[model samples]
Target: MSLAARAVLVHRTTEYEELLARHGTHGQAAFFLAARGRSVEEVRERHERTSRALAEVTAAVPLKWRRAQVERADLDRFLFGPEDVVVVVGQDGLVANAAKYLTGQPVVGFDVDPGRNTGVLVRHRPADAHRLLPSVTGVRTAVDDLTMAEAVTDDGQRLLALNEVYVGAPGHQTARYTLQAPSGPAERQASSGVLVGTGTGATGWLRSLWHHHSSPLPLPAPTTPHLAWSVREAWPSPDSGTGHVAGLLAADETLRLVVESDRLVAFGDGMESDALELTWGQSVRVGVAEGALRLVG
Candidate 1:
């Protein structure tokens, strides 16, 4: 790491703020919560805990290095330096949200509710950030480079995913597409969607899908370099086939999908808000990303 390197903190909007944004007013937000037998105080408490965690993280970064902070929703607008050390202060999922925008910058994930969190990605606690921040920049420190998944459209729009990428109809309606693996013949299919998950994501959505399989398959480790692709709820029909429902994408291979429907969408790490849209006759290639997350625990 360079002496001029800085710390970039990735923050997420609290649940209360989201409710306020959705309702347009505090009173309306509170009423909606009350109807669900919840209270504003509960949301406020959660926000307060996150606030204190952020304060700890903010104070822990060295004053010699410049600091930058951005909310998860505004990640695309932020400019990350090559020497920046990214700090994610939220749940584990927030770390995944930040990973897509980063290009090999060392990431330190701190769990806001450490005691309650059983997450694998966000391993550090709020109180330990002070010690962890310096370690990430230490000369002798080594970080793990975790594999990431990606989706590239025929027209060249690309998206990186730290966990998994969902490719399918916007509303998850039956997806009509032709799936082609590196060495297999293309097969038309109708399904809810296709999920391409990295090794780190196997413990997440991929795990649930794995549980449904009659014969269990080996789930990848966090640092596995390949991607696992699966079709969700495939339905075999006159025009659709299911022979190519699951496969592994080696680092050098591409899993291609030719769209046969009116429209299909692709999004990474469950963030549907930022997605790529594909129309009929379009194609999307799924593969391992060249830029992986350099994570420090």
Candidate 2:
């Protein structure tokens, strides 16, 4: 018999909240959306759905366990404990955002609205939490150890990516860097950017890049131990030789990049809000992260 655990509900800001923030008032936001055939009431209903889903998950938790709620914006500052079991009541992107920050705690992805949400990470509904809690709390349970990517700068700064890592100049401009992989000659290259993608992210930006060419590379599973790297729009010039533009990275392998530009940025999972700045002569090592996201199905 196992004891109870802390259940942290992870949620994102509502559309209405965002609209109000952008338009400066709910009335103004409603008028803006009304012009596009949307009503403020519709946004309010979606917000209520998320709130109701949170309540449902809360009720599912056993009384002996500790319960808390957290917004996605506050996730970076939140301290997660070893025994914590996270229940995310939002879309898959919320889960992706949280994955980069988690140590190894099991995350229960419960979709707030199944009809409208294509939540690949949120496999279960809020009502399913009643039966799923045991899987996280019980001794014998199935947990998917989802692989994650990491970027380590030469200066010792590190960033984790749940989906893919974009290393390039700000504003998606041209990037100049040296590409180095295991058992290969270092090549200088000029390109828009380099994207390091995991199996889970293959269906996202990587998929588009994969289709950019006639020959498509095989994508790995979400829990696969490997990753893929692709350089977007590699330009060959006298100063830049492009040989190693795309390749697969083994579980133990890493892709090392030496920045040649005046400034470079590394961000993960399509979130421009979080990133690392790389300067001239600096290098960053991109590879599999030491930790994984324990996803509860």
Candidate 3:
């Protein structure tokens, strides 16, 4: 017996009409989730428009509407059977936020910005273990419309680190914060915010705020004594070398910063973090998280 193929179609706006037109079939239900908050009337209208276009190809196509923050357990129920595909649609920020709920499944990402036109998808089948996923045809044409790609995870971690989570003191403007890494303790600049980045976020705003170059240039305490004393470069390098500089700060997708006195604010990847407070002389751990996300072309 042949498999009754099931595909989950996810997109943000009406622009994906062309891609949906290509892969969506009659029996498969297209799930529409919007990143932005829209009124019931507006959402219903959008669904109706897409439904009409889908019906032209095949009748009996079910269209469902739900709040964008679809839970992981619910998705497990929705994709109970095998051969089901999950597609996530949004700009880079929205896509990164949605990834948290996806956990360990193959995720197809669709973004509209050409600069953000990238996707991470994973294939886990043993037979096709090493083969690459086929690149989305006409991707350039849809560069402004939709850029679809996939992300894979071996240990069920999201691959895209678009920002850093920061934790800092409350109320006090420009508080001195203690940064605790595995090795030792260091005093970071006196500021309302302090940020840490993943390897991927080295090129973001953290570099600019510190006046450090993106490439492998070693960071020294700036000649200005005030900035140098507060924002010191603990890591030492023999000379400038590509990809050999210390980890970045201020602009990481997964930033965790500690504020002075006793307040902790942690947020990353454009998502909100829980408020935490730690007393003085207390230790806060900081480091990299090891995991792999699947990448789809």
Candidate 4:
């Protein structure tokens, strides 16, 4: 909590902003939404609320502290100092989006429109910033170090995600690969993809996958130092088997995969644009990341 520490405010472009960008004008954007039976006024109100919330949070920062702003798209290019305190101003997914690019820096999440986004990560409001900022800087508040997932390839490419990491084909074509569980025999499988998720992700895409597939493994809690993995739609054929479909990976263990298809992809937290590509015979290892998200309320 040094006085020289910087505060990095993180945010994402809103729907209204996207509409304006796409339509080229407010009137056109309104007309576009009107055609879809959606009201532009509502979108504008939410955008204004987000703007006010961001302004309030910015004002709440200590006057002496150095501050900077970064959009979600620029996070990969933004440099975060060791003593930086990250302030995420958006939905829970935005927190995940920022977490991958961060190290051990503490994060404060603020929800702009709570009614529309009842997220688990964004648990605070702009009004709480004044009181919370001091606690975060002083290290006097409770912080939850949430576990995260990692995917590393043999060629030195690595990716991290706050929720989960998906490894599969680039398109709808079946992903052909050999999956080796942490403590069992490897199995050649053909299916949609493979998903490795953390406890924070268990409530998201992982949950949906778990519901469809029954397994003896229990889902990890938010702070658990473990990961859950599952293969989507494993097709059992003469060359491929579905013996290893789901399992749990300990913090020290890893699930390995070897590509048998022409090309495969690995992405985290649903950001497919920023992903890792693998060629035939490439290998990847999925496990719990060494760094965890330090979230402060």
Per-residue lDDT of candidate 2, residues 22-61 (tens digit): 9998789889998999889988899888888988888998
lDDT of 4 at 111: 96
Error of 1 at 5 (Å): 1.8
Q: lDDT by residue for model 3 over 246-289, one digit each (tens)? A: 34322111222344455433344444432334545443433333
The local distance difference test score of model 3 is 0.34
Ranking by TM-score: 4, 1, 2, 3
Every candidate's lDDT: 0.88, 0.87, 0.34, 0.92
lDDT of 1 by residue, 146-232 (tens): 999999999999999999999999888989999998887889999999998988998889777766554255766778789888889
Where is model 2 poorest over a 10-residue stretch in terms of lDDT?
Answer: 210-219
Better of 2 and 4 by TM-score: 4
- With a 3 Å backbone cut-off (N, CA, C), the pairs that clash in candidate 2 are none
Which candidate achieves the best lDDT against the true structure? Answer: 4
Candidates in order, TM-scores: namely 0.93, 0.93, 0.44, 0.97
Count of clashes in candidate 4 = 0
Please state the error at residue 238 of candidate 4 in Å: 1.0
CA deviation > 4 Å runs, candidate 3: 1-86, 113-162, 170-173, 181-185, 210-259, 273-282
